[model samples]
Target: MAAVDQNSLRKLVEGQLLRLEGNAFQDCMDRLGLVLYPGDYQPVRAAGPKGDTKNDGYCPKARVFFAAHATRGETFAKTKGKIRGDLEGCLQEHRDVKVWRFLTNDTLPGEVDQFIDNTLRPLYPDVTIEVWGLKTLADEISKLKQGQVERIIDVITVDEPEFEVVVLNHMKTGRDLWPVLSNCLGWLPHEEPHDCTDDEQDLIDSAVQSFRDWSDISGDIEFSRFSVRDAQRSITAILEELAEKRLGLYAATTDDYPLTGGPSPFLGTVAIFRIVRVASE
Candidate 1:
């Protein structure tokens, strides 16, 4: 076997680190439901306080700060020092801001971790710092992929707010598995019910049954795998049927409202469904 060239190894590591940082940044933003404005620069830059002056008036309302490094030892130290200096400057400029740091690298030295906890954290209490080595990013990516599965479910249930609501409610009711399911669903586990009543339970049950029936029908009519669009259509069809029967489950008024209007509850249900499917899978 031939030994790998040092230049080639460096290039490969750099490329991988760049890609991973981009992905990690995107994942963090998506998890927080943030609409990321385009950034012109890479997450990590070369070490120095020279360009630090440019950030004098650059107060960003970013909840998180991410830095990626491709090398270890002294190189890591120099890069971290520059980033810390820059961020500290930013924090000093903006008094009431909090920033979380995510550091991505193949390995982290013990002394560096200690420095982060003991030195940097104490100095900047407003900045919450988290370090992710290669293994951590790998694990996070796996979890994100699982979340994507439920996101597909959300897309399918878009048209069926009633069904989505019932599914979310059922997820809340199931004691043992509910927490795990709720994480997948992107909903915080609530100890108290969110205004679900006995009558609402009956409506929810019917809606869930309608979804299952539609899933069965979809399996027979088209492909084996159930698509979210099909799920949405099925939910919509069921809601329309219930409305025709004067069930009074949905609002009677057809007037357009804001995104946070009467129909917004149903929209939230769909959002929760997507979150659950992504997290669970």
Candidate 2:
């Protein structure tokens, strides 16, 4: 990728992070928590009345809790309120909370940042309080593997538009594919944040390679040497990982079928994820 494209992609990813609100932003933080804390990170969903059990999530191993409050153009007062409420909830509701990290989209002013360190720290002397804004989230994402980053971002923009979607879509879809493929592959949920081991990474890499290989097969080649089942499994692995209900790949035109003597029989799988923006949420 060119520097310009890389810059564009970074901005695109960061923009998405900053713009996400409600459950979408909380979901993003859950994904990030899984990456940053691995097996220890547990995403807490909002209960009917309890409301996330006083925290959005936590890592038992580290005794650290996380709370997400993502809103665009939010005032410092609102942010501070959320921080105080969530922090108090976590501290009062949970035991042995060594750290309470508030995740938000808006950047905190220097004074607000200092206030957490100073005023908040004194009130909650037993637990450390920290806030993570867009930059902090982006920095954490930078440390992830390309596969992991693609999953979080849902798409990777680059020079080659087709390859950009093809590779990254598979990565993004891998999370979606987890449920369907888990039984067959004996794999963990890719969509959920978890500690990915080396063997798990290898499984993911192999699935990606298989999809690429299947996609690259020449139509003129003899079918006898290839295991159609094996190829199907690979393709299935990739497609299953994609956003199913919100996204679909349909033939744009039947006129392009090989029987029609069309120049390009394949519309290209790149079309499958053009709407990832909708699917990702």
Candidate 3:
């Protein structure tokens, strides 16, 4: 697939920020918080008769509080007053705050920046204050994962055409198969595994080092006469030999595997390999 145009995406996000205000702006920020912190961002819901908690969201892990003030043609003084009041209320209610982020829909005025730096910082000597205007919000949203960003904002992506297929019957072998598979097939490595256990991490590290060692000694395995049919025959032969020796690798050939509904147009005949992590079974 074609990579997302980050510059264009950021501009779109900034434009959205400029347009949205009040509850809509607050909701957008909440969605961004969810994407940014994943499970860590806790959004403060509606306030009762006692009035709002001032904090729109809080990330407990980072001890960061978010207060959104979206203006709808409000004056500089009015905007500043709202921000100052929210900060005071949030500080009072949430004493453990290390960073208080003030989120706004539009670019902050010079006087607003001065007020926060000179007036607010002196009042709250311990807590750090941050202002996230349209540009700042756009920059942050742009850096997030493509999938996460897609959930928050409208995105248009180019579709991938005719990709070489890798059908692993046993998918748990994970990306340890990438180096060898990438050499055999034309599959390019894309994503990395996240939150791996110690043992899994060790295996990944060892696999990487092994690939490096092999490359340094024998150099990269290149198939100058590489073709889809030739690759299929080679893989099938290898897997069948392993199976015969009871080395725990299995192979199956089928034309039923779905790529764009039924079998890939690129690889004519599909061969699926089941890789088992065992000497014999």
Which regions in candidate 3 have their CA more than 4 angstroms from the true location? Answer: 1-4, 154-281
* Candidate 2: tens digits of C-alpha lDDT, residues 95-129: 99998888887777886788798889998798878
| TM-score quality measure for candidate 3 | 0.53
What's the lDDT for candidate 2?
A: 0.56
> What would the C-alpha RMSD of candidate 3 be, to one decimal place?
16.1
For all predicted structures, in order, the TM-scores are: 0.32, 0.53, 0.53
Estimate the Cα RMSD of every predicted model relative to the unseen true structure. 18.8, 19.5, 16.1
**Better-scoring candidate (TM-score), 1 or 2:** 2
| Candidate 2 deviant stretches above 4 angstroms | 1-9, 156-159, 162-281
lDDT of each: 0.38, 0.56, 0.60
lDDT of 3 at 217: 23
Which run of 10 residues does model 3 get worst, by summed lDDT? 257-266
How well is each residue in 182-253 modelled by candidate 1, as lDDT tens digits?
A: 122112212222454676456656754443344333323444234544455555665554444333221111
